[model samples]
Target chain A: MKKVAIFGLPLAFFLLAAVFLMRGLYSNPAERDSTLIGQPLPPFQLVDVMDEAIQYRNDALTGEVNLINVWGTWCQTCAVELPFLTQLKDQGVNVVGLYHELDSDPAFGVKSVDVIRTEITEMLKTLGNPYRFNMLDEGRRYSLDLGVTGAPETFLIDKSGKVRLHHIGDLNQRVWQSKFARLYSELESE
Target chain B: MNFRSFLIILFGIILYSVSHSASSVEEKFSFEDESKRALFIELGNELRCPKCQNQNIADSNAVVAKDITAKVYELVKDGKSKDEIISYMKLRYGDFVHYEPPITPLTLWLWLLPLIFILFGCVFMFLLSKKKQVDISQEQLQKADEWLDTK
Candidate 1:
């Protein structure tokens, strides 16, 4: 009984720790809160990908519900989400694409900024251009301010310029039909 | 050379190579003021990269970390105070971006768990030693009894 008591305490502690560890494994880190959600878009500006003359600022998204998608040509998932974005655009959903410049790594398959833009244009032509105007986040200053950890993240902004939702990962029809479309319509009514 | 001597030399070579490579690749950032430069370095060390999760912004090779390091440099240049800079990151990225998270009801467990574990460990060790001492004393008592019986 004494031996059992001596070892049992540590055994119980180990079992408790194991339970917590198992619970942690089930909790997805991606489901974490965006501190920027419900807050106004941070002051940022991005130049147009196609036209250097055009610039997009936080004010540009004001007075309209806009879906700001942070995307890059290098991200495989972004390419997959492109068609869905185009479909949303056809349905008159205000979708703005922020072209985050990936590093000039051969592994990413693109080399220069010019090539990236050319490829984006080509992709748009082939996949169908959904973006109202693609904004070039050249230095990723805007992306950093927007708290984008990776490419293919989407932020749904309300008419008041507040970010309604921030989603990380590829957005497809099911995502649109399930959460985003309903939320967008709710904001439109407001 | 002995196996032990070879292992020591191998460790030395690895350490020297790592330090040499680190020094060669380290990116240098220029700040207007000396204090601002210090602050920039401090911020880099303090801020955790959201993407890398493990590495600080200064050491992380991830794209997000690079942007954050640049942003920190920019903020320092703009004459924003350290608190303001931290607040800026916390506002966007939440508490995960800062190495030192604020004390709140939600984070109480995270802060107190370590202290609780230490206390438990101390008590466990104390009880373990006491039990060992009691066992030794019991053995000593048995030996004395046998000695007396034999006598």
Candidate 2:
């Protein structure tokens, strides 16, 4: 009994540690709950990417359920997912683009608005525009406020403007079916 | 070369490399108050970059890290306290933004597990020592005494 107890205790500990370490190996480090989930969209007054004269506020997105996609022309994944997002938009989903500009910093030599507009137009014309309207995230302050780590993230906002979900990577059919579709339907019903 | 001269050369090389790397990325932010500048640097060290998992905001070249470092500079310049800035970041990015994790129910085990392991080890060692002492019988003690006398 004593020998068994002595051997079993350490064996149990080793097994437990092995299981924990093995789980860590498979777990995605980037996967974490967003702090802004269940919170209202952060207040912002930003101009449209196409036309700076047209401004948008937090209330602009509150009237209905919307998918705010954080994307940039530079992001390859964003380009790849553009068609899928456009498909969602065509299927009566309100898809808004949050333009996460990379070269907004003056220190890094900022791009002119005309240049950015041309690039956006060229990209959207080629990839099919998924956005209802693109809000220019100048300096990426609004993106930062939205807890955005990088481009290619998407946030699902309900009718009341509460953030329902924040997905970090590209949104595809598989992701939509598994993560977004059911909850989105539930929100639509609500 | 002699061992001492080799070590000196190695130490000199290490020092030169460190100074060279430190001068490579010189971000100039002039502050009126030296203490605020220090605070800004301190906050940069404490704030973890969200995009790059392991690197601090100061060390990471990720765009998000640059945004965060800029924000930290702005907040520090605005005279926000350390805790206020930390909480502000926590609001946006959750507790993961900060290097020091709060001791919650889930994280409490991180602190408790080491103590538990030490206690168990102590108990196991105590039991083993006690068993060793108990294994010395009367005949063994008599034999030891005789051996000592002869010696």
Candidate 3:
């Protein structure tokens, strides 16, 4: 009884630690949720150029080749990637732009929300309208669901709402020519 | 062994204990920069490690916080800027890595609240201890009255 009293808590704690170690070893990031890829794209209601409504967020764009590009007007890298995104838009691909909170612009120094209006207006003025539709995420309500860390993340969502490719930084021509097109065709068949 | 020899042995033991304690803090993590090292150790003593709740990094047996503290020592040795080191730590381990509970306006209350509570507690106990019951038995009261008049 005395031995049990001394050893019980330590033994249980050891078991808990072992469980966590096993989980970390076996868990893979790719096996995460991909519901947004193949299903109806989520609603992203944002104000566009000339104060027009942009319906970039909807359930309709799912089960097709769609690119959800994460950007903010404040981020230098995102601005640099704008010309490349414009080219992808010209290719008749459904390139959807998800504006990060605080506009990702260096000037929109909110340190918090990089919302849609700032991103759309700023980019439209400089880079021209590369996106067929744009959504305003003023509060970044949906970004948390998208698993964003650093900005300029691009997720290639297939027709089934399954994410086929998740790129961290820029979406350059070399990336689209090699990886993006192949993934696009793969999703088309599915 | 004379009395002087015995005194010398006792003095040696005292010296050894002092050096041992200092060296333990040193051997764990040592830096060339004396001022930053002193600040790190002083800060380590005051700020409780979030990973090891009961103890600060200086006091903890935690491997993660210990590695971080050791890295802080190394950076201080290398003359890396303090702000850069702090931000690097924040990026790698999140804000919880900093033990010094940052001096924000909202957090001023965390440090102030407990200190105020302790001061009040001490004062209340002191005032309670000073309370004395009056000796109000008839003979005592008469004696006290007589003594007061005599004085």
Q: What's the residue-level lDDT of A31 in candidate 1?
A: 61
Interface DockQ of each model: 0.62, 0.73, 0.02
| Highest lDDT against the true fold, candidate | 2
- What is candidate 2's lDDT per residue for B78-97, written digit by digit as tens? 99999999999999999999
Against the true structure, candidate 3 has what lDDT?
0.64
In candidate 3 the C-alpha lDDT for residue B129 amounts to: 66
| Inter-residue clash pairs, candidate 2 | none
Q: Which 10-residue window in model 2 chain A sums to the lowest lDDT?
A: A102-111
lDDT of 3 by residue, B107-149 (tens): 8988998999899779978776665433356798889899999
Off by over 4 Å in 1: A1-19, A103-114, B1-27, B31-37, B113-151
Candidate lDDT scores, in order, read 0.86, 0.92, 0.64
Per-candidate total of colliding backbone pairs: 0, 0, 28
Candidate 1 per-residue C-alpha lDDT over A1-190 given as tens digits, one digit per residue, 9 for 90 to 100: 9899779988998999999899999986666578888899988767898788888887999999999999977788998998989898888899998888775543234577677778888888887778988888877777877889989899999999999898888889988888688889999999
Instruction: Give the lowest summed-lDDT range of ten residues in model 3 chain B.
Output: B88-97
Compute fnat per model. Answer: 0.88, 0.85, 0.00
Which of candidates 1 and 2 is the stronger one according to DockQ?
2
